[model samples]
Target: MAKTLLRSVGLFGAGMIAATLAPAIGAVDVGTYKELDQFMSVFERVRADYVDKVDDRTLIKGAIDGMLASLDPHSAYLDARDRQNMRTQTQGSYGGLGLSVTMEDGAVKIMTSQEDTPAAKAGLKTGDYITHLDGKLLYGGSLDEAVDQMRGKPGTRISLTVVRPGRDKPFDVSLTREVIQLKPVKWEVKNEVGIININTFVNSNTGDSVRAAIAGVQKSLGHDPLGYVIDLRSNPGGLLDQAIDVADIFLDRGEIVSQRGREKGDIERRYATATPTDLAHGLPIIVLVDAGSASAAEIVAGALQDQKRALVMGERSFGKGSVQTVLELSDDTALKLTTARYYTPSGRSVQEGGIKPDIIVPQLSDADYKARPRLREADLRRHLINEAKVDDKILEDDGKPDPRFQLTADGLKKQGIDDFQLDYAIKTIARMSQPPLRTALAGAKRGAK
Candidate 1:
């Protein structure tokens, strides 16, 4: 069986950085030889006439990099350093600012910052552009270069010139690098409700961590709590098998997710176990997702939502639905190639459109929520297109304001509610526990706004 996993830079990776081990291909046709001949022609010219002295290894590596870059943004050629970075991240420990970043038009754009890390502590939000590193311009630099610069000996300080969307001008944020030891799952009981925070799916044991969290919640409360709130905000995905495992924990039956390759007959579907594996025991559950929840996170959310096991709340997801298979070209090199497009159990492809939440719960805690623009799979250059047409009207509808969400950050703070989305989700579950209080509380909460 192939070992399928996803990774980006740090905890919450940027774009879709996942891979599966594949055997080397040996077939080559005459038409390919002609293309190789053309490539060799350019290679010879660069080697002979270039002003700077170039080595064969460097030229070949550059050619490979250019070849992969021509494809979708998710595909890339991973060198030794990149492979080591991927391994360290999936293992749940690394030294860096703990930010998941990607290249956009030669500038490095932040995907999301991992919780409790140096980047998150420094208040770097998604969609912020890193224009300079240590007062040196980083524009037109490769993502690999940026990542290599950011990740280094722990405790070393670095300054970043950030260009935020709503800010009047660029600002410098100084941060010290630290080892990011990821705790994939964290559970706590709030108002007799279980809140499970899944930070990332990069860990192979993430599914097991979630299972432990469920058991811990029950043990901590002396019984099964009212329900669970699976918080997947800013969680850029990880292992494919762990996604199936996590989704399987909630679903007793039915398909969880499916991946389809280029060939018409090449399709694989993952289903939940028939056993009574629903740990919550049919309790009311809610899945919270934001624009940063992607790939494996979307898989779990899509499975639970389609199976009617949980009510998905919050804003739309990051919408990265493709799978990358890492083919080892050499001992120290691999090709991360996008080979398939995954779909939800209900046959919905969340490529550019993402997983639309059943309830659109905006984050009222952030004062700059409305000013900051969101970055998703659709926004990337050379992204894979979803064959099924997406309704633009439906996509545009998510931006509209709701009367129930009229509260400002100050208003929420005064009410002692720092996170309005989480507070609302917990209150919603509390209402479900008491059916009689639903109408009265709903009216009061909505009318008060």
Candidate 2:
């Protein structure tokens, strides 16, 4: 089946090609004679006429980059260093400065500091522009280059110059690189509610971590949690199957997600097959999402919300409904292509326009521009563009306050709800624990069963 799909995509590419060779066998024939002649001509010209010596590796990397850039945004040729970093990210462990940095306006800006990491420990806040790395000026360098320079052996020190928001002078700080193991799921029993903060949906361990968190909360509560606060803030999604597994843990039996490709009859649906292990049946649950919550994370939030299983709070999610398939090239390098798109159980495509929260919350304040702990619109610019529409019927117009529930620079000043959206979720869960609402939730669960 996989081979057939690949062949179909290859055929489609060939059919669309105007100047390329004809489609033959499984792969498209790229006019062998012409390619050979062109290659020799370029090689001869370089060897005969070049004034300066060019490194072979540099030339090859440029060629690879150019080739992959023509396909799509997600498809790229990763060198050895890039391949190693990709492995580190997926495994959720690395020796680094513990900050997610990106190239913004020609400077490396701190997107979000990982919790309890050296960057966070050293008071590195989001939106801080990194000007220097290890006392060397990082002006006009790519984010990948800066990040690679930051990662090194454990206990090695690196210096950074950062310009913070509302500050004119660049601040210099030195941090030590350590073996940082990113714990995807973080749960705590707060006011008798299970507050599970899922940073990302990666690895097989995420489902296990969530179960453990629930068990711990249940043990402390002397019963299963009466309510749950799922924090998916800043969670740029990871593995798809893992996201489905996480949703299955909450739902008894229902469709978690459905994916559809361009070809007809390619529709596929994944359903929940087991009863929930954490909260008892009909337990009040609220899922918190923001612009940073995306992809597989959006899948979970959208599924639960569509089924009326969880009250989704906070701002609109970062919609990333496309699916990427990693294709191994003849060389050791891989091609990650956006093959198909995924939809919520209700058939809403969260592509361009992400999932709208049941409760619309804007960011805390206009002037207090602290980067929310989730992926924002700016972060997703590098991803491929595949637009999908959302059904208006499934969306709720809960005319309350905007769910923008982060700690605004001003809100941080006063004693207001720092994370007002999460606070609202907690309060909503508490309210739902009342007899009447509990009965409604019970009915919903019974219908799901």
Best by lDDT: 1
User: Per-model C-alpha lDDT, please?
Assistant: 0.86, 0.72
Q: What TM-score goes with each of the models?
A: 0.90, 0.80
For candidate 2, the TM-score is 0.80
- 6-99: candidate 1 lDDT, tens digit per residue: 4122221111111111123445555655666677678778979999989877887787778887888888888888888888877757779999
Residues 59-132, model 2: lDDT tens digits: 55666677666754455665556656766776868889788777767888776677678997887866678898
Looking at model 1, residue 411 earns an lDDT score of 94
Tell me model 1's lDDT, rounded to 2 decimals: 0.86
> For all candidates, what are the clash counts?
1, 8
| Stretches of candidate 1 exceeding 4 Å from the true structure | 6-31, 435-449
